[model samples]
Target chain A: MIQKIMFMNGYGVFVWFSFAITFVSCAIIYIKTLRTLKKYENEYAKELNKLSVSERKIVLKKSKVASQVFASYNKSF
Target chain B: MFDLINPSRVFSWIQKLINFINSIFFVVLMIALTFALIISPPDYLQSDSVRIMYVHVPSAWIALASFTAIAFFSVLSFIFKIKNLNLISKSIAPIGLLFTFLAIITGSLWGQPTWGTWWVWDARITSMVVLSFFYIILIVIHKLIEDEDKAYKAASIVAIIGSINIPIIKYSVDWWNTLHQPQSINLLKGTSSIHSSMLLPLMLMLLVLLLYCALIFLMKYKTEIIRIKKKNIKRL
Candidate 1:
């Protein structure tokens, strides 16, 4: 039964290859996109931290995205 | 209101949505894979190779749908001058490109056992290749053009023009005597030549892929928002 499922009547190569490629590609994209998102989130937090406390406070007050990103980035770490 | 889709509003939801999808994605994928590979009945004609349709068809559908969405949003952005819509289009382009290539590759894999050849310059296949090129051009434009406004304008034009090929891709199998089969599922007419057993797996796989696309798009969109915010931090 296991062998039958794997072989798929000798067409298994094509079938498995199709499914494998589709999934592998999806995984690669997922990882790369995740990495890029994390990098940007880190940068956003880092850039905000580069400022003095007063300036950081001003930014956090003015830009909701900066504050949210900084918080999210901290959560990740 | 446009405020409904503002990045600040959307950003809050992205993480929650990502976590939600991550929680459910693997389970859905396993179900889809089981049905697609082990449970679904094989074609009377094509045999076990028909399983490829579960992936190929969904990928093709997504590729086509993504481009249509990008083109529609591009036109809307140009008319409404909505920066958010442009960001949405930019995020969608890579996803479209990835699926287009997947469709072509899997179709080729499906072809070898069934068509006796890996590939042929059939009308449908060639048009899919063309669609992929359009996706590449759209991405390249965004990356190469330094000026944000110019990139979006150029991309909008390209998207608007590239959309013309969409219908061609859809009808290519019918219009030309291509080796590719005509569309089995037609949403407008509410018809499908495919059996329910096969359709179930196809739809399940589609759900899985759609969830995956959503996860990727949200991440990319979040990155774009952060990059913009980082650039503007000093000004803020």
Candidate 2:
């Protein structure tokens, strides 16, 4: 069974390597998008901190709502 | 009616649904790949090399589908003047481009073994290359035009215009005598030429890929909204 899969009648190299490359590309894209979301979230949080308390409260409330939506979105994964 | 719906709440619901789908996606993908590579019997003519169809066909299908989606959103954005629709198109472009690039590379890999050449200028292949160029152009337009509204308008126009190639790519196999095979899965006739074992894995992989695309699109769209919010905050 092992040898049959490995050989694939001499077509194994092309088939397996193509799948590997495709999956790796997908993984890279997923990681990159996740990192961008994290960076922006941190930056947005820092911006919120600089505001006065009352003003920050309103802004933070809106932000919280938005983040809650995204949290659910992320949880689905 | 539009104002009555809270965008955040809708987005939250979508995210939760995506999360559920993704959990299933990974498992289905693994089983599908194993079946495609190891369990399924080889073609009588093409032999084991036929395994490449599982990946190549799905990639090509999704690439074309993604572009069609971009064009669809672009039309909605133009008619409704909705900025979010434009943003959705923007977020989808990179993913569409990735799949187009994959289709080309895998096609080449498949071609070398079956067609005796790594590259060809056939109608089907050429139109796909044009589709990739359209993806690149859309991305570049976003970067070059700084004004948010202006960039959105320009990208939408490009997406709508470039959509002309989608049909060309679809019909190219029938329109011209090419080495590329005609459609294996036909919708109008409600039948497919491929064997059941081969078709099953192909369909599963296609589903998983499409789910993957949606996951990526949501992530990018969320990032875009956050960036817009950040800009609004800075202005105040």
Candidate 3:
């Protein structure tokens, strides 16, 4: 017990306390960022889920048609 | 190869270059921490307590550096209206605050041994405490405002205005007769008091901290960018 206390030298109070604060702060930031990212990803998946398969197919076809029109326009040039 | 002939090669080369730079940063950081821990001689007076300087000083250095980044990027964002730049600066705020707090705590720990006090209102300590407060204020400003554009603008303004304190903090020892020792590391003298063994580790610690700061900043910025991109895609 004496050796341990002397090792810390009463400065252990300060040193260990600081370390604790740093550890907790880092953990909080990491956890908060993780939760935020996961929440946003889940919300995005839900939004995508709202779209019916037929609607997505229609949107895909429209984009393909638009790209083809641009390609033909380049060919005419 | 020319950009017209091999765009993908150029893209791959850029990616490779970035990866190389990141790898170099990590290697240097690891080397620095190793030097500090294993190679550096202990202080004659404080002994192992001096080791804390390895972590403490560098954290403070990077804390200041991160704010410098935020200030520069905020200015760029304001001038260019680049969404990514704004997001990157905002994302870095909390990390900078964490480092600032860590530095202060470690400094206080060092002080209990060296100065016989855990806390003091010395110029360096007080200014560092104030710097932490400024970071918190910037974060609060970002959180309080609801509109993204307006919030970014407001946060950028706060970051820029708060940056005036950075120079003051750097020069506080010189400007005022303070309990804090004058900075030992200067371009003119180049750290005269410390032995080479000690200096090497300190330098290593500094290098590692700077690279770690960059890595964390980039990681956080990338995370924010992905979030923004997803938001934009959803809008479409």
Candidate whose DockQ is highest: 1
Per-residue CA lDDT of candidate 1, range B33-64, in tens? 99999999989998899999999999999999
TM-score of chain A of 2: 0.77
lDDT per residue (tens digit) for residues A1-77 in model 2: 89988888888888887787788999999999989987876677666666778776666576654445335445655
Q: What ranges in model 3 sit over 4 Å off?
A: A1-28, A52-77, B1-34, B187-192
Q: Rank the candidates by lDDT, best first.
A: 1, 2, 3
Q: Can you give the lDDT of residue B205 in candidate 2?
A: 79
Please provide, for model 3 over A1-77, each residue's C-alpha lDDT reduced to its tens digit, 9 standing for 90 to 100: 55653354344455455545654676577667656654654554444446677654544354432223234334545
What's each prediction's TM-score? 0.98, 0.92, 0.74
Residues B93-118 of candidate 2: C-alpha lDDT, one tens digit per residue: 99999999999988888898888999
DockQ of each: 0.88, 0.54, 0.15
The residue pairs that clash in candidate 1, if any, are none
Q: What CA root-mean-square deviation does each model show from the true structure?
A: 0.9, 3.0, 8.3
Query: TM-score of the second chain in each model?
Result: 0.98, 0.94, 0.83
Model 2 lDDT at residue B149: 93
**What DockQ results for candidate 1?**
0.88
